[model samples]
Target: MKLKLLSITLLLTLAACKSHAPDASGPGTAIDPPIRPNPRLAAATGFDFYLLNLSWSPEYCHSHPEAAECASHSTFVLHGLWPQNKDGSYPQNCGNGPGSQTGPDASRFSDIYPEPGLLEHEWRTHGTCSGLSANDFFSAARSAYQSVKIPSQLTNLSSQTSLSPEQIAALFTQATPGLSRESIAISCGHNYLTAVAICLNKSLHPIACPAVRSCRANSVRIAPPR
Candidate 1:
């Protein structure tokens, strides 16, 4: 009788242990943690900041009249988003990923890069070094472009205008709240305003770009969009 009682107690204890055992395929099961990408690896490879290049379409179209972007009569169009070092040197062709291929869809950037060739060239030459996929890199470029506020005078010029590089930089600074003279650099070719380059941090905030050479022309002509 005692032996029978002891067996019953042991069986009950075993049953209780089995019931309390952690279930691998049931509720309350502990799941494995998800893998995460490394933060440092996800960022642009060893770049100090970004240089957002904005080309004056009228100036560009004057030389390349056949370019598709000229048809839209845009004032300021995207040139390229370049990864630059603090010393002004930049990286190019860092990888041969999807950005280097011709397959990545670029229709979404028609307003920014009206020329399809320019889109592919920029991605292969500059975006490849950005440490982001083609989509993310272009998205960043688009966002950076949209953040800048073009001055009303430049955007709505009804006639040809001329201004000093310093004056142009001042106009940009006044239009963009956080932009400053030190952060803006103007480029000119043959007395025509060609492009405006703005320096920005990884987070796309305006920053000083002392290394970029600003146009030394005393006065540069601004051609109205044709």
Candidate 2:
């Protein structure tokens, strides 16, 4: 038994020595073979995520008082807004941080990305824009659903005033020019995308005006100021 153990120990030592053995090619001068493409690395490095801020067209909403009033008051309506992409970046403005109630607000209604249902409701009730394209609206809606950011200015809006949808739409119109109620609702949809690009945050995710969302991981919750 002792001899057998000795033999086994000797074999293990030999294996260890072989593993730590120096290369005949020399030390640092040894050339390494080319690295092969790894599927795992490729997958880890490859993926697609879209994010941005949606802006509202206050000018158009203002001119159309009827619609403006409706939009302002509606709780869930996405009105008079556009996507802001001032800086070019993916997951645009995912975490823009918080805003102070003081000082001039960056377009109070600037945040407020709503869902399709609320948008349609606002159109039907305030702008008489029910005839607008649902496809375009959905494109924007889905973008918001993926993530929503409410700016601090809008937080004040929610707290200070409960304007009717029409008033809300009107307020938007007041901010813009060369736009009518009929055209504003339809055009605003496109504007939303443009606005998002403008106001996008520096991060890879969309900036939550009130809160940022990390959809692939964690989600942010922005509370409207009281």
Give per-residue lDDT, candidate 1, residue 10.
Answer: 31
TM per prediction: 0.78, 0.23
Q: Give the total clashing residue pairs for model 2.
A: 74
TM-score between model 1 and native = 0.78
lDDT for model 2, on a 0 to 1 scale? 0.25
lDDT of 1: 0.69
Per-residue lDDT tens digits of candidate 2, residues 1-226? 0122233323322221111111111001111112221222112111122122232333323333344323554322333222222232111111211111121122322343322323332223211221113333233333332233233345344422333323333443343332222221111121121111111121222222222111121111212222
* TM-score of candidate 2 to 2 decimals: 0.23
Weakest 10 consecutive residues of candidate 1 by summed lDDT? 19-28
In model 1, pairs of residues that clash are none
The lDDT for every candidate, in the order shown, is: 0.69, 0.25
